[model samples]
Target: MSESFNQEQNPSEEKFTSSFPPKPIVEEKSQNALRRSLISLAIYALMFYFLFDRNIVYIAAILLVLIIHEMGHFLFMKLFNYSNVKIFIIPLLGAFTSGKKQQVSQWQLSLIILAGPLPGIIIGCLLFWLNKDLKNETIEMLYSSFLVINLLNCLPFFPLDGGRLIETLFFKENYIIRLVFGIISIIVLLFLFAYLNPILLIVPVIIGLELYNENKHQKIREYLKHEKINYHVDYVNLPDKDYWLIRDCLIFSFPKKYNLLTPGKYEYAIVEPIVIQQINAVLQVNLNPDLNLFKRVLMVLFYIGIFVGPILLFLLNR
Candidate 1:
């Protein structure tokens, strides 16, 4: 934690800038490799203290798997020009890299998202292939953990790599398609929760609930489509002031014929039916103001887990 803080504070840290979005933010620079070294040393010291000193080798193996998995996303995201990357190892849940929220095409997003779990699966397979004998317990355990974690990450649930793939690859332009996806995800999770451990159950429940709540607004949105665009949300209310509404949106509009939008596609039109000589257009939307309390609550809980729940898990599982 100290090292993480120092990385943020280090004045000489490398920075990347961008101009497409006006504010060129740091794209993806690891602050002082020395800070990372210190953090790794600290984590090792702590893990060694807790997981039996002799288990240091196993812990290190786990860290290696995690780093490779996260680097998959980090590397690919950089290749695609996602700036200001911050890769952090999150215990229990694995790792992730966050960067500038760039507007991406569906294909690009799919590739970026698929990059994370593919590497994990590849590495797990490689490990299994290398030790077909499976005589060493440490290698066996590592192999199993990697396979389990990677497979679980493969499940389609948002914010998860698989979910991102679905959003990017199989994404449909219609609200009905997304609604179907949400419903199917819930049904699959119901059966999954029944067969899985309680600890794993929470993950799907949280994700499913979020999907359901988000989809609940779909009906209202569809109903409003027949009407002219009159709805809009004040950006000031957003946690991130620059946030834009995704799915079932109207990017731009004209008086009689509003241009409709789908998840990752754009729809644009000239305001006049015979505007061969002149053009003037504006975007209008009937923003649904209804908040999904359940999703909001679950999101808060998920964030709490990200920050504090892992520490509790370490203690309980220790």
Candidate 2:
């Protein structure tokens, strides 16, 4: 079903023509993405410095730990042939590695999740035991910081690596169950904000935005499915008509979010980039997730062991 980029618009935006396959407005090279990643990481570090008011040593150590943690996920994603993999450091929050893939393996996805925190936790525990007697203040702080951040990430809170592992293994296909888990994550995170640093409340705020975005994407996907619009393909392969169609859907979905935008207009808007970003987000490869119950059970045990193994090792060494 071929359609004009602006099927509903007047004889305007003539330059915007639908082609056989779509082209991205800007080419997002891995090198450029990596450079942006570095810039963002620098910004995150500076923000962390101002937020914590800790000794420079603590800030440096925390930054190093986050880099290592995200690298663990990044490297594994590369190993699994994930495209567009990049680490994003969220200011005053945390870091995450993002990539795109159409047919994801459940086992590999589980490894990618574990890969982030497990190694950092293990290394931190090792450093702690090795320095128990020496007690160098920097090493002590570094290891403690590593344990705290990575261990918190291991918690089954949505958007965290551990929560993602659980969601992927069990509720990946279960929308109702996933929604319930998301609500629980929100409540728990609110409690955490009341207990921990209020600045960290930005995390819950981001999670709320994520939930809103997810709902919008879900609705878009359902509508597309009803209209028999193909979207299972990766980003680059998305047709121009489909892109415009999704953009209209997004504008309709978030009118207030993207104020002053009308659906079905082909005129390029100031928020085109953001709208394109959402289209990319809404387009996903159907997860292969070739995981059976037995494999999933084993993955769960492995997930638990990531937390328990380090503690067991530290206790035994102590």
List TM-score per model, in order: 0.49, 0.87
| lDDT (Cα, tens digit) per residue for candidate 2, span 1-318 | 122223453212344344424434756687877788888878887887776676677778888999999999999999999977888877767778898888888889888999999889988888888888897887888888889899989999898888998999988877678888888898898898769888877787878888877877887777787668887877777877877777767776776887778655556778777877888888877777688999898888887887887788778877
State, as a TM-score between 0 and 1, how close model 2 is to the true structure.
0.87
Candidate with the greatest lDDT versus the true structure: 2
Residue pairs clashing, model 2: none
> For residues 3-68, what per-residue lDDT tens digits would candidate 1 score against the true structure?
211334221223311111211122223676436644854675475457555466666776776677
Tell me the TM-score of model 1: 0.49
Clashes of each: 9, 0
Measured with C-alpha atoms, the lDDT of residue 315 in candidate 2 is 83
